[model samples]
Target chain A: MNGVFAKLRTGLAAAALASTALAGPVSAQQVKEFWHYLGAGGELEGVEGMMEVAKSKIDEEFTHRVVPGGSAGLRQQVQVSLMGGVPPMAYQVSAGLELNQLAQSGRLVPLTEAWEQINGDEIFPEGLIQVISYGDEKYGLPFAMSMLGNTWYNKGIFEELGLEVPTTWEEWDEVATTLEENGYVALTSGGGSAAWTIYQFYAALFDAAGADGYWEFVGGMMPLDDPRFVEAVDLFEAHFVKYFDDEWTGGVWSDGLDRLMAGEVAMYNMGDWASGYMRQRGWTPNEEYSFFPAPSLQNVTIFQSDVIVVLKGEETDLGMKFAAAAASPEAQQAFNAAKGSIAPSNEIDPSFYDPIAKMEYDKLVSEDAIVLPNLYVLMPSGFKEDLGNAFTRFGATKDRAAFDEELARLEEMRKEMYEAGEFGTF
Target chain B: MTTLNPLAAIPFRQRDRMTYFIFLMVPAVLYVAAYIYPTIETFRLSFFEWDGFSPPEYIGLENYWELLGEPRFRNAFFNNLKWLVFYLTLPTVTGLALALLLDAELRGSVVFRTIFFIPFTITTVAVASAWRWMYKPSNGVMTQFVEALGFDAPNWLGDPSINTYSIMGAALWAWSGFTFLIYFGGLRALPTELIEAARIDGAKFWTILFKIKLPLLWPSTIVVLGIAAVDSMKIFDLVWAMTQGGPYRSSSVLAVEMYETSFVMFKLGQGAAVAFVLLVVASIVVMPYIYHMTRQVDEVKE
Candidate 1:
């Protein structure tokens, strides 16, 4: 009788397994494609990870696919792909030109219904919402938010060097000089093919240009002949050039943060993703590494955010569901904690973040913190490349001749593009 | 069921025509659709201003007009020209030398040939990574070797003046194996009697290489140079992976510039113009080699 019972139990278990296998494909026939820049071993793994967790919350019988690509590469790919009449359900794009152009093309589904689905106005700050929206329509869901002017350092290195958090230009210079004197690379910052690698200097330029000048400088309203612009360039030379490592010119932004984590350098200037990357690499935050808001501009926040845009199609329902889940307090908290970035939803409590991210996030929400867009985020991409070429020359040698000539060329191009109506009054 | 041939009802001559037409249709259509059409469309697009959005506008030759005075475009073009010169010389010479060395019947010749051919087997991405690490600042293999020899090494990828050559060195390292394999195959087909006759005449190895082998290797030389020249124009992956045409656009090539303009800058019209110019340059390069090869083939047939 016992042997008979065992055989019956085994048959029942096999029957259950077969039924589940039969039901999976039937249920998963409906699916959504989520395109993002996981970029192989990045701090943004949370974007994909939380998508997996959010799958359970997706009430529809829809499966999801994560399509990985780099930021700029994905933009180009999406451009070409959409030209072919097939686009992924959603993709990672920055707020400025990428979103603006895509929105203009009528390829994206505006977030009217999706924003309502996600509870956007209640959770996200107006600044973030403004960043992701254009033409008064929300077009994307913000996943990663950074107060872009934070400086990351090896806490152990700082303790060993007896360095304190620097607040002024003079103090920062002295601290950097001491680190260099002791056998440390005072700083590490680099850029690759993209429009990054100039942001670190942009932060300093912010301080040099002051609050009003910085805003005007980024907005194309600032004159090319502004003495403050020249001072800003000089400030970049004094801070970034003086302490740069030998390998600073040809790498992506992450390389510097990686070096900081490796303790080969004393300091780095980037967004809060540094802490996330450190955690991903098994470093305990505030122990192995630490971060501080970029000095002399604590009142100003240079913001960086990555957003997902829903494409209009039969799968819009599933895509909107994914976007809504991404904006949920639980999902945002889980994702941002893992990503080393702050949740886009401002309602998330500060305690959910690590010390570095919390401090940065608190400022982003603080009454006195003023939001400024980095050139990489706000400027037109063609304008960005023109600036990139000029910055490369400006970075190596602060040659006034080359600087002035490039500046003139840029202004001319901007004038032509503006007259042609390329910038579109944004 | 019996299979039937529609051409069976026709005369043999007409059937032959029909068979040939059917056989050639797919590829001919493909060539027109994939290659010829796009090339021609690019020319048309070059005259218009299009941002991949909105309707394209007729901008006359404004895109081409911008290039005449653009310093960055000039830098990229001249850099490509430098690559053209480098590819025509280094890989061919090094490859010819290695092929001659390995064309012997010595023991372990296969091992030597394999060792020399290994770099070509590795993909360009992996090879670029290896070379980039080898050229890393202050602590890389090349940097350390220079330092040991009592010299301060410039950052290979950071210095504008030297970065292109540094990238070319990596390209040549991977490409030499390919050139060697091509020459080795050519050498295998050479008449052994010529080598034996020279050796019997007390000819030195240098004389044998320069006079008999190299003179006979003319066909291979033309083909190899043409391949390298055309391949050199499309040199983007190595530069993109290694330096990204950087340290100040000193290493920027036409392809990288075209990519940035079209994709990053969204000036598809201008990017099309750059592509057109590169296409013209590539054609100018390959045309002479084709003429030379065809002439050689005719002489052989005669």
Candidate 2:
């Protein structure tokens, strides 16, 4: 009876081995979670679709999910979540202190090995690649990029009012005046929406200061009291107070975007994300809406990118695949197409983008193009906030002295931040 | 009853001690873990300059000193004080009025009560969104109404001069329900004979409200004031969701400031300092009331 039992066990074991051989390699029990904030049909949605594109490489071993919140609210959630030990395997962060500080401090898992494995160097431009790395290590992979100075306009309104896309500040002002005189929204710049819109000061300053000071101003090496700074602020203050409706402070950036597309507003300068927003609202680019770099910003792209950060403990094999997949040209094209933003990968097919994105992309690679980093992204945490508050105060200023005072106030804060070495490696 | 209380036959000390500890153990452990530990940790954190992730450096009183010197801190502190004063008085008065209006127990009073309580039931995020629209200068209902009435509505959420009051109005709308419910409960618990006697003595509505009812509602008033004051000290979500402590940080309160410092700015030490200051301020406002209440409880027991 013992011999018979042993034979039976042997037979069963052999059968199990045969079944395993036929079934193929079993994937690990892992799911990579992505964190971003927004609704079902925007950036987050576009990313969710990219997970499908990634499946051929990673799906056998990994699944991806997204947790969402408001933009700033989501950033806070990622920080607190990391502190709680378990964090999103990958999360979207702006390309600056939030990413750099974490990446530099080694709290974030560097993605260099993954980038190398994926041949990211060949896919992304050297300059673009350099922007996403910090302290000689890459910590984030770019998913979506937007230039902040893309002033979107409703084509129908432009046609109705006989307005051409303004190529300079003077022309922009005249257009604003024309739109307002015709009883339409002129420009959307102020409070109540995303405060980062206030960073258009950098854009306005670019036009006001010429390219050299613009570079210096944004490099965090220039004084806020620069004549260019005052000129930009004065231009900003006057334009904001006069052209913007009293409601801009109550409505956020998206509000202006919506109003612009609906033909209620002629123009509003927003990040490249506006293309995604416009598309999400079912508007066709060029036909329904058209955009250009902000007036006076010659061949400039003040870009902000949403980069995927892999947390330290979350550097599992599957996690790396997810990060690599995020930066894949295929993923970038799909995401940019859906998100109405340009793909960060230079190798991506231009045909994958909409007309507006293609136009922006054209400028991005132009010989004259100067792709300045988004000012808000470069500033330390809450520094952009300080600038926004000062801008608001400046909006309420009646005279040059008060305007100069706000500038001095911002300069003092920047000086203190500089002393504290917040600029790090500017 | 004569069945000999066998359970009670045990010595009072033993029964009381075992039961007390067994019941209190879970709560005591939880309290220590959740509240006391964090409070102590925050106090300790206040001394060190640390971003949430990085190694903390001992900065001693530097964070506190900066808090004292910072203008934003002063603004937030003053704003909190404004919230405290406005909240303690306005909500209580309006709630009392609402309670009185609904206290008549007339037809549809229950409906009226439910309607008033609805704002309190909605989440703060939703409440802020709703009120933000109403306070919107361009197309908000309030703005349109004012314009219709032949006056320009000041930017309710924009102007620093009136933004705080505009927010206070929303807080009042959302919070008055809880106050009303508490006051109503207190009125329910009052001696009906006193009100009836006043009525018989020709006490009108105003007289009954001022003389008979309000005097009897002292304890409820104290509770409302305590809750309102403490709650106002921690008003963050509404202020953050609505204005983000902005239009220029004019409407910033201590709670919003603390959150921005700690999370947004990642200045853990400074944020902790703000939290400590807020705790100290809240305790200062609530302590005397607590002492008085404790004395009152002792008197009742006596």
Candidate 3:
């Protein structure tokens, strides 16, 4: 009986090997190439890891290529290629009204059917899903979600000063005062890069006032002349002028992180990806360093989601299949596990996350915080251009009344865009 | 020689004329195909609204209208003017002075000339990158030196008002060398008899330089000015590498603006319009100088 069993096992193994050999040679599945703007070391590693998994488990014959560059370079190159009529199969894009524009232009393949078939709506956060969906049709899949409105601080410094993490605007001011008095730079950030750092200040202000109301004002759904919006803007300007670095005007985001890591600064306002840098420098989360939502912002968190959009191509079916694979729970887990971001799909277990990441992930899942849409994404082309100019002027000039005037102009432009049916109503 | 008809008096045979036409036409046609055609195409594109990916929609002069209205474009245009004016004047003055000084018979003058020209040999990107590091507030050598001297270092690249100036300093460093070489060559060709006559007239050294040498060097100065003017008007790489037109739109020049509009903003028509505007502006500024210089050359020959 033992000899018979051994012979049967060997026969089955031989048959399996024979069948595998009879399978078509490699390069059977059409190759789908992608380009991305994820040039940071950790993000590149995460992408490579995902590629490895995809190659091993998914269509073995298919190939995945990644060309990485800085955001500006990638945006320029992608624009050139698309306008020249040679867009890649897949590319990294932010989810928002800009994406909606892309969809309307018919450059992107409508993934509504695939999304419905895969039940993507049920897995992704509703706000995120809504951001990527335009005209009641899905165009992309979310890959990573960021916790954008978080303050990262040196735990050692806070402990030395005997100050607890604050959870309110008043408390945050006190902490800033204490840190300043103690000969530490209270906060460090750069506004030179299109006023992105100012976003944190605005997010906090919006939180303190009211997130929904703030969005309505910025989106021009509410009157820009509203005194509440002015108050929020005033508060934002005050903190921006007060607690930021001495060279705030010249600062870059990477420089801020470097200062915090080098112990030259006390705290920084940044996204969760910052944790990856801290971890790389031999610091453990919640011990050497800790992060909390910007206390002054109330419960409003500014989040940005990374979404994958499939371009219209010859291999549309294969591209959709790969996109679906990218959206699968297994892919999300593998990607987010390496990426230090929350899996876009809610089905992934939060327990598998690192302790600090898990905390932010849990808060996002529970609170369902509002995702702030950048004006560039939400407004029409002309309006967005005008608004970008206005925002730059406002940030540089720091004249509140002038800023208000710009906001008014932006509101008028938004109204015109809406009237012209350029954008859907909120 | 036998008396020949006026038509036959021409130097070339009919066959030679055909060969000459072919020879000239080949290079001229190539130049037009490679350079002129693309420029014309880009100018044509300015009249059409296209994102570059899709087919362009004909929208005559709309891009130019929008560009004129856009405040950022205005700022960039003004910045380009500022760059051209300052860049042309400062470098030519410095280079001419240096070339005059080095033209004198002095010890180790060859070494001095080599040292002066060294910066120009370095790549523009490298020069920009090095300056960026030096201007860095945290780890820059200049910042550390300034801090050590018990002074606060201003954000060189951060301040909108001074950012272009800071980039100009780097550009001038690269440019002064080229001007020096041109002035050096001109000095070498100066008429010794004229200088001796000026000295005999009891003219002081300053008067000699201003009156005689300068007038003699006018041809070289014009050439240098023309090159520098064109270069400064089209300056892109150093500013892009250094400031990326940041700290608000303070450092933005027309070239950077054009690139951002065409590529970053994906407004190809607007970019094309900006490019054409830049071309016209550059032509307007340069043509008179070129004409005057050519006339000066003719006067010198006479």
Candidate 4:
């Protein structure tokens, strides 16, 4: 009876092996999970496109878990998951201090080998690469880069009003006046939306402070009483706050975008993702609408990127391969096309991008483009929130005294942060 | 018929006590694990600076000190106090008034009660969304109504001066239904003879309501106030969903501040400090009520 049972077991094992062989190599394929907060609309499409592109470049199968909540939500979920020791193969994060801090905590796997495999130094710009790197190691592979210092406008409105794309602050002010005289919202956004309102400040600050001064400001070396800083605040107020109509207060960012498309607003200064949103809504770029880099004293590109951070784990090798795939020119092209962002890699074929994106791509690679990370990307955690709150209040109340008080507070905070060496090599 | 009764040797009183304790053990353990442990952990975390992932550095009372000096914190703290005061009084009064009117057995009172109760049945998020539209400055129902009367409509939500009150109004609309149900149940349980006697003695409606009915409704009031107090203290969803405690932290409360600090800012220790402050405030406000309820229970037992 024992001999018969052993023979039966051997036969079953052989049958199982034959079935596995019939199933082919596909059955044995490694499956890696990626977690991201890009759950809806263009971002979701972009992420899916990137994953599909990655699959063609790598042997592993990638599955995605759409984490709800935007960056803040993703951060909370990632922190909890990492603490619980069940982190995924990779997760999405902004490509600066957000990644650098995680790397500092030693929770992330350095993508140095993956970077070398992908020829990262040659393809990706040195500045952006350094922004996403920690010390001498890479921890994030950027997939989508958004130029925040750009203003999207309705081409038809500009044509109808016989106005030109403003390339300077004076020209911009004149254009805004023309739009307002024609009973259009001059510069529109979700007035109650704190983050976008804060971006208005960052963009204007770049325009007002100039690239070098802005760098000094971010480095905490600029004095609080700097005229450029005051001018930036004034420009932010005039564009983002004072012109904001009461009707717009109850709306969100998308609502502002909708109003702009509908010709209710003349212009919206936002990240390139606004273009992604516009494209998703069937608006053709550079036809019905167009954009220009935010009016600046000198050419500047305030950019931020979304990166895939590989976790340090058993699936680390698979994660690196996935990151490498994301960094590949083909994947970057596909992802950026869907995302309405410019490819981070210089090797990407710009012919695949729309005209506006192609222009952005050119600017991104241009040595004359004074590239800097967006304020949120440049600042550490608390500083961003503090600045955002101050801007939010100023945008709503337009109280100069309160704004000055906040500036004072921020100056103190900057000193403390600088003293503690919190500005991590940005 | 049983082989041997193990519990039979035990005294009846002790055996009953043992059964009670065994039944209580499950919930007791669960309570300790879920609520008590987290509360204690939060209190401990309040004393340390943590960024969710990094090793927590001991910060002692610095987080608390910052909260004190922070204007946003003061704004949120005051907003919470306003919520507590309004929630404790407005809803209870509105509910009582509705209950009394219904108890009078006027025509269509049952339908009125159901209509009034509808807001409570809908989720707070839905209610807040609906009210937010109504409060909108441009073409909102409230704005149109005000304009129709030949007056300017205030920016119900946009104006920092009135945003908190506007939100409180929505909360009142959603909350009064619950309080009405409680009061209605309490009123129904009251003896009819007492109210009839007051009427026979020529007591006015107001007099009868204040003197005869309201005093008897203390138990229900206590229940309502207890719920309202806690609800106001931890109010987050409606405020967050509606204004996100904005146009600028104008309508922010302790709960919203805690959420922003912990989740949005990732200042876990500061968030914990905010939470502890809220917990302390809530305890101080509710302790007297708890004691009163305890006394009420003890008196009834005696």
Candidate 5:
């Protein structure tokens, strides 16, 4: 009688196991793990809200891990894990060569099918797709877009000085001179990270010269000795020397921001994302601070977006599904609204955006600004190192002649990279 | 009597010998496997070019050749040499002198000894961070103090020429305590009778220190010098936490350069190569001291 009862129990267990197997693919009801580098207080809260909403919509248990890192740290961790045959289900990556590197390493799953299934090809902006896609393969889904051409300022200081937002390079100089005359540091800049603050100068210059002309000269389509490139370098160096604070050489990006917030400096050129920091410090847009498109240098603004890539691993199918869900219009609206950025998916209502972000987005869309790939992403790693060295030299010397010499050397390096086909074929 | 049962007697001695060998060799074997094997692997890895992710490609001596030619690497190597010379000598000398002073029958000697050794109690990261803030150009305490004294405060970290020296000043503060402790113990262990005899022979204090104390403190000197040399060669934490080998890589040491090349640049092979070169240089500097010490130990035992 005991043997017969044991056999009955085993039969019931097997039937239950078979039933689960027949259910066909782990449903959205299963637990999913997500990794991100959003460790900042506001950003972390925003991500948690999005995750909560995602879990509510899907039948799955959501587990989100906040990876403590910046871009380099995240990349190193992800790359090491991926190469070692273990990778996170999903993680955020910058759109471009970072995505390309993952794809080449066979650590990224193609998301073309996922995009089609979700109708992302229609909802997402073509420009954003172009940025995140490699060849015929899609490795990431864009969630938020950042505007890189905004110059934030202390509104109180500007109003007291009766300085209007400058629209051209000459006017910018006048404003800087006026501010300096009034005992305010004209501009706050930091060279600690080399490329972070310098990108503003590079983008402004690229815009002024016309996209084609800038690329032909600075991008090594033409010789480094081109007079136009030298002129641009001189202009960039002159502005850097004339306007930036004396202590800028040792200051980090956050320090410059702190100086601006403390009213020690009148203005700083940075990305739209910098507003998040200001908001966190209890400064509201159009009240304590205001931002405008950077003046002069051809009025061109370069844009970029942050993307989420599904790392290929044991749970790749689940990872791809999670990334797709994260990229959906509903998810984009929830995430970008809380995080203070524009959604890459055009389906989201503009009314959901904050006043500052809406204004930046409208301007960017209407002007059809050029999206210049970050130099670090566009150039080979070695070339990026050389470029950083050159920038360091330029910052230290504050010499137009030296800047031009460095630009010439950079041109040579870019040419070598182009010939080697290091930057992927356009 | 042994011939009656030589085999039986041999087994007993063999058992004792086996136990002795285990006692002596186990700890050393574990230590070498844990430490020395990894170090040798790091050297071997120097010959390959890898990004730590991709499969490592054998690049022969290309990395070494490039390192020899690269201006940044050369600057770091030369700076390391400067650190070894200045950092090793200045702190050791000052520490020995302080130790000698304390060894004398001075009032509150214990308090003075504790006070002098306080800097070593602070962690390297904390010391470096404090010093970095102090050396800040505009608002730093050092800058403020200098300006109060009616002098301009040069950019201690920003200026490439002075950055390494500034970092060294911070290092010296943390290191002097350690050397002082070693020397203090050495001075305390000296035979009192010999010193008393030298004083009775009309030897002056300075003459006694040079003629008697220093010679007897040879063992301590060798140990201190060896430790200081090795520590200076492998210096990383303070430099990393303070300047990050920056102000245009002026403060870069071999360790920092190796890290940047391997992790930041994703060039692991080159990083390993730099590390190996650093090891070779360190061995060249330290092996002779180690050999001499070993020989001295043998002589003392004999």
Candidate 6:
């Protein structure tokens, strides 16, 4: 009688195990974890909006982790997570150097298959796609972009001086002189630690160096001592630096914009974000203030984009689906609309863009447009930092000898970095 | 009274020893985990080449060798030395002067003392930002004052040649209040008869101060100098918030270099190497004070 009871209990246990196995996957929902630098402000709203648009498209439920500290903070957190062997499915990273670093570390898997599925090659600019690519594989999906190299100016200041928007370097020189003669600060950028603002000067440099020269320079092929590069540097030192505010080094990027807004300064060379700053302050775009691409870079589109990078993880397939959603037109529209940045895709309608962003979109789609990644997103982080420092020093001193020495040092540094296999193809 | 005392059976001395041991155990474990272990790890990692993400490659002193060749590191090292010298001298002297001035018996002197000490009470970052605005080239208070005095106002924080000194000026302002408080306490605690005797001997005010008061203030001096030395070595928040070791690292110091290398440049091994160098240098600077204080305590006990 005891053996009969034991057999019955064992049979019941087997039936229960079978039922549990059948119910597990159906009952449990797969959660895809994503990391982003957007926490507070419009960026948070933007990410949330993007996720809302992407929710139906992606098969799995996803949770977004707001990583504080911008790109630097995101990089540090991602490093810690990767070291712990629990990297998130995807994270927001800049398109070029930041993404390349992770890809080179073997932490990120290529999203090329996903990219092809979204018709990314057809929609995104070729240069932008390359910026997000590592070696032969695509590692990032471009989402939002800001057009660089535009000179944001006070329309009030221009009207007071009767200066039309300069369409040529010579015309800009006259306009700058006129503004200066009228006792208005002609051109300015934040120096000191905020010296990276001087990369706007590189737009002019890019114009001096044609597409080929610019490519060679950024690709670590062209030496800084090259005559063409020197000429570009000379233009930056001579023309732009001539009109730079004597006290510019004391202020930061926002201060420069503030000066422009107050009509004390005539022009500021900054990214599209300056317009957002202006709009926030109740300054009407195209009426109170307006921007135009540097006359020399009128045909060249210098852009910085935020990208979604898929890391190696258990839920990589879901991560790819999210990347696809991020790259899709609907999601891009929703994200960029809230984020105050223009969509990376050319297919996105321009009706929703602000006046300045609309101008950027038109220029981006123009036949003559030669799109290039901004210097910040083009070179390795170390080299980029060194270059910014060099420029800041040169901005203050204007000593040609010291500038040349910096150039030589940077050339050698770039060579070493390239030899160490720290770069991707231009 | 017939009472059961569990610990009484143990000798008083043994019980006392156990009590001390129990008190020290937590801190000992914490010190090893928080300080000693991490320091050892930092020293070990300094010999490897790691970029935070990849497995550390054992490079074995290559990081140090490279640092020696790097111009930026040398610049930062010298800047740190400049900070050390300035901290050791300027704050000490200015604080002594202020203490001497405030030591006088006068009305409303306490209010003046409080006013001077206010800066020290503020956070370093706040102090830095305040000073940064005052050093702004265009409309800074300093610039406006100099310009109003019929002189051309040179760029305070913009000129690389002068920026370190400019920042040091701010540091002095922030830190002198601390030293002044110490010196004031030292002055108040002094025996009045000594100074009275010096005055009765026809000694001048200068002579009395130099020959009598200054020598007696050694303990306060030591306290101020020891703190200033360590503070100088680890100076980061001020320089970082103000100039970020820029106008091309002209104001760069060892601590700033360490942070930038580790977090900004993502060269963890190289950054650790910098941190180790800082630890060694700081230890060298602080060790003598530690020994001196411990020796004083031993003598007192004797």
lDDT of each residue in A1-426, candidate 3, tens digit only = 999999989966775454333221221222366567665665767666666665665563445445554544666666655544455667777776657766776767888887987698687776677678877788887777777768899888899999988887778889989999999888876544553554565564464457566556445565555677567666666665467665645656667777887777888887777888888888898898988877644445466777778777666666676677777777777778877888878787777698888887777667645555443355455565555555555555566677777787777767776667765333
The Cα error of candidate 6 at residue A120, in Å, is 1.8
Tens digits of per-residue lDDT for model 4, B1-302: 76488889899999999999999999999998799867877887788887776666788999999899888899999999999999999999999989988988899998999999999999999998899779866567988999999999997877789889999889999999999999999999999999999999999988988998889998999999998988989999999888889876788999999999998777889999999999999998888889988999999999
Considering every candidate listed, which one attains the maximal lDDT? 6
lDDT of each: 0.76, 0.76, 0.74, 0.81, 0.73, 0.82
- After superposing candidate 1 on the true structure, give the runs of residues whose Cα lies further than 4 Å from its correct spot: A1-31, A39-45, A48-58, A113-122, A193-197, A250-254, A261-263, A314-322, A424-426, B1-6, B104-107, B299-302
> Who is ahead in DockQ, 2 or 5?
2
Candidate 4 local distance difference test against the native: 0.81
Model 6 C-alpha lDDT per residue in residues B95-169, reported as the tens digit of each score: 999999999866889998998788789999999989888987767899999999999998887777888999998
Better of 3 and 6 by TM-score: 6
* Model 1 agreement with the true structure over A324-400: per-residue lDDT tens digits: 77777777777777666777787676686777777777777788877765656666767767787677666656565
Off by over 4 Å in 6: A1-33, A56-62, A84-87, A194-198, B1-19, B197-204
Candidate 4 lDDT over residue span A182-265, tens digit each: 998887656555677778777678767876776677666766678988888888776667766555555556766888888888
lDDT of 2 at B278: 96
Better of 2 and 3 by lDDT: 2
Which regions of candidate 2 are displaced past 4 Å? A1-39, A70-89, A116-122, A208-212, A234-242, A261-263, A314-318, A396-399, B1-12
lDDT score of residue A299 within candidate 6: 82
Model 3 C-alpha lDDT versus the unseen true structure: 0.74
Worst 10 residues of 4 chain B by lDDT: B48-57
DockQ of all predictions against the true structure, Cα-based: 0.19, 0.22, 0.19, 0.22, 0.15, 0.24
Q: Chain A of model 2, TM-score against the native?
A: 0.82
Model 3 per-residue lDDT tens digits across residues B158-187: 877787888888888888898999999999
Write model 2 residue lDDT over B1-302, tens digit each, in one string: 55577767779989999899899999999998799867877887799887765556789999999899778999999999999899899999999999988888889998998998888999999999999889866778988999999998888887878888989889999999999999989988999999899889899989988887888999999999989978988999999888888777888899989988987787888999999999999999888889889999999999
lDDT of 5 at B48: 78
lDDT of 6 at A180: 89
How displaced is residue B115 in candidate 6, in Å?
1.8
> Cα deviation in Å at residue B75, candidate 4?
1.2
What value does DockQ give for candidate 6?
0.24
| Candidate 4 deviant stretches above 4 angstroms | A1-32, A60-62, A234-242, A246-250, A279-282, A351-356, B1-15
- Cα distance off (Å), candidate 3, residue B90: 1.1
TM-scores of chain B, in order: 0.95, 0.93, 0.90, 0.95, 0.91, 0.96
lDDT of 4 at B72: 86
